[model samples]
Target chain A: MRELIAIEYAKLKKFHALKIIFAVYMLTVPGWMYFMNFFFQMEPGMKALFTSDNPFDFPHIWSYITYSASFFNVLLAVIIVVVTTNDFQYKTMRQNIIDGMSKQKVILSKFILVFFLSTIATLYTGLVGLVIGLIESTSYDWYQNIHLIVLYFIQTLGYFSFAFLFAIIVKRPAIAIVSFILYFPVETIIGKIMNADAYQVFPLKVFADLTPIPFFKSIVVSMKDQGGKTPWILDTNIQIILSLIYVLLFFLLSYYLLKKKDL
Target chain B: MQQEIVLEVKNLVKNFKKVQAVKSINLNLHKGEVLGLLGPNGSGKTTTLAMLLGILHPTSGSFSWFNNGTKDENRKRIGSLLETPNFYPYLNAYDNLKVVGIIKNVANLQERIDSVLELVDLKERGKRPFRTYSLGMKQRLAVASALLSDPEVLVLDEPTNGLDPQGIAEMRQLIIDIAKEGKTIILASHILAEVQVICSHIVILREGEMVYNGSMNSLLNQEQAFRLSATNMEQLEQALHAISGISITERTETDLLVTCSEKIDGSSINKRLVEQGIYLSELHAYQKNLETIFLEKLTQ
Candidate 1:
């Protein structure tokens, strides 16, 4: 497994396009945070929201930045698609098997890349959140709600695992990327049509629920003049568990398909 | 009393939907023997190699390397180049070889990569990306990749596919040198002459079926053909008919190609014709080549 992961790194580390895309992903998350911070600070009327705390306060900022950073998980997901499909596009996965790696290992290598990318992205987002919350917020309490970092990692795995599945199924890089991106809206439309209980277990819904829009819940509560749970919203624990299931299911399906198909 | 078996395939079959690509291919390749896999287009040559390499799953059948079942670990012992040189187009030769090294778990990867690039005569351009390579250079890099692990078995399909004449000669010589080192090589090529020189055994496939399988010497040592023509054509033909074990197989534009069962020299045939009051002008020995035997197998 260590060798397989090393092989994946050797194949991808020098890849300029992949590096550029990854750099963009890492930068865009913090860049978007800074942009959002600027937009929020420019406005004075928004201070009323956190119920009793401002959005940038240390504890609130943890959830706020994590919620904001999770949206960019799609970039890491795209990276997954590109990395996996490049093997197919270049016919290198077949070569890897020919060179002595197992077909299962071929798929496992990409899964390693998926996990590796998600871990780095999560760590980068966490570090950026910590730095920004430290500099922007005036609170000595750094550990408050910091467990969102773990949630960020799981959210990345959710998006990236789905992207890994799409890459294996689609093969062609362009087609895989386009379809992977397009599936969000397609699932959104499908999720809207499903009943409330069924929609709670849907893949995209569960992954999205990992980091709900930070202040949106409070804003909705203020608007409603009453505090109540929506029928479609799943408990974060349930969402995390379901997302882990989807990750396992997607990778297993990918392994099965790769074994069955002729490279 | 028997040499080790490098590879054995039994009733190997592959189907693409309704179409069968390889039909029950059965052959045994012993150690230190160069096996030439010959077939025309779409004869499942590539498909067979693919199955053995584990890139394409066989529908039903089995093949083993070094008498071991198709284990993933055994594949690392065999280096193979299937179809084209599969590499990251964005990576240079050194980096490309590094990927192969990692896959095969080659120790001292940097040194191995350098040695292979040097062997392929691409040392100067080792850092150049694969996309910028010419067809010949790309093919050479593939050969380098296949040899990087110093595998016990080398499976090369069209190793000299896009090389220039000199490059082909060099590549063929490299294969010969490698074969001389007692490595088992399974070569699939359209260049029959090249196979005739390097391979010790041959397998011919026609339309997804094995038409011929045996030693190269056994296949080539079947008959001796001589293009004999004389000044008195009628007397020459009659004399050839009178000689036992000599049958005229075809009449070319200027000579009668007589297939001789026994190994008779050109001088002997000339002397025999002269004894019949026939003056000989042409008595050229036409050696049986792989091309002739391959075509015969295919047509059969």
Candidate 2:
């Protein structure tokens, strides 16, 4: 296990795009949150409207930050797609196997990298949530609703797992990236044509709903009292379980593709 | 004493949909034997090696290393470079080798990496990224990586495919030096001369089939043809024809060319001519080189 991590680190430690994309992501996650905080404070009418919502409040701050940061998981997914497809593009996976890495280890190396990246992303999200909440909230319990950070990690794994699948299937960085990027909008369209309840159980829907829009559910609940037909999403715990299942499914499919692959 | 069989391939086969890439290739590579795999273009030489290295799934067959099945740990004992120099283009030679060292689980990998870099003469340029390397440098880095583990058997496919004349010579010498360590090596190449110079045994493939497999000496050990001159050429020609195993192929004013079976040598023919009261002034033994034999094998 140490050897696999060391090998992956040696391979990507100098990757410029990995560094740049991650830097951009790290900066934007907290930077965007701070920008929004200032934007809301400067607008009087908007402040009056959102005064009741208070996205940056202590307990609610966890949801606000996680929901906002979940979108940037695409950047992490792009990193996964680029790094995984790089093995195919340069044919290094074939070389590594020839050099004595088993097919299982090759897939496991990617999993290690995914786990590492998710941990980094989660910690940053948690730290940003803590600092932002401490600054904005007047009084609160420290660990109130902090489980969202853990769910956010699961969501990150779900996104990266699908990215790995696309890379393994497509075998080209550009095509894999484009396919992964297009999947969300495309699934949304497909879900629209299909039954609303069926789409709720879809992988993207489940992962996305893990950290659902912070105050929007309450707004929808109020709207539902007035006979609004907004589609109902699964509970957070169910979504987490489904996301874990999808993560496992994607990893297994990736392994199957590699085990049967000629490369 | 018989050497241990290091790698045993039992009728390994591979098929790509409608096209069969390899067809039941069976051979035993004993320890310390330098085996050369020779073939023309599209002859499945690379495919056979890839299967042994687990890069390709053999359609229906098996192979063993060191009298054991090919397990994950056993793979670390074999070093292979197939078809091309594959590395991360953005990584330097040292970093590229570090990945291989970790995969091979070599002890004291830093020192091993340095030693291999020195062996390939890339120690000076080890820090340059692979993308900035010349073809020969990239190829040398590949050799270094393959040697990083100092495996029991080394498998190389066309190690000098795109090298210059000097680079080719250097690469050939490198392979020869490694073989001198009494290590088992399986080299696949199109250069027959290269094989003739380095390989102790040879295997020729054509259209995914094994056409010829034998020791280099057995294949090239014959006295194919000879030129002889005698004081009385007429008498020498008659006496040569009298020998049961040889035939006079060419007759000229000054000499006669005799094509003979492997049993016939210059002394036997000389004795026959002298017995018939003819004295020979000149006798030259001419042997057929590998290219002609290889072509003949392919055509056959």
Query: Best by TM-score, which number?
Result: 1
Q: Provide the lDDT at B124 for model 2.
A: 86
- Model-by-model lDDT, in order? 0.86, 0.88
Could you estimate the TM-score for every candidate?
0.93, 0.92
Q: Is the docking of candidate 2 incorrect, acceptable, medium or high quality?
A: medium
Clashing residue pairs in candidate 2 are none
The C-alpha stretches of model 1 lying farther than 4 A from their native spots are A45-52, A215-232, B234-247, B260-285
Q: Residue A90 in model 1: shift from native, Å? A: 0.4
Weakest lDDT window of 10 consecutive positions for candidate 2 chain A: A44-53
Q: Individual DockQ of the candidates?
A: 0.82, 0.77
Model 1, span A42-94: residue lDDT tens = 86455444445666778788787788888777877888888888888888888
For candidate 1, report its TM-score. Answer: 0.93
Off by over 4 Å in 2: A42-51, B228-259, B263-282
Residue A179's lDDT within candidate 1 is 96
Highest DockQ among the candidates is held by which one? 1
**How many angstroms is residue A76 displaced in model 1 relative to the true structure, after the best TM-score fit?**
1.2
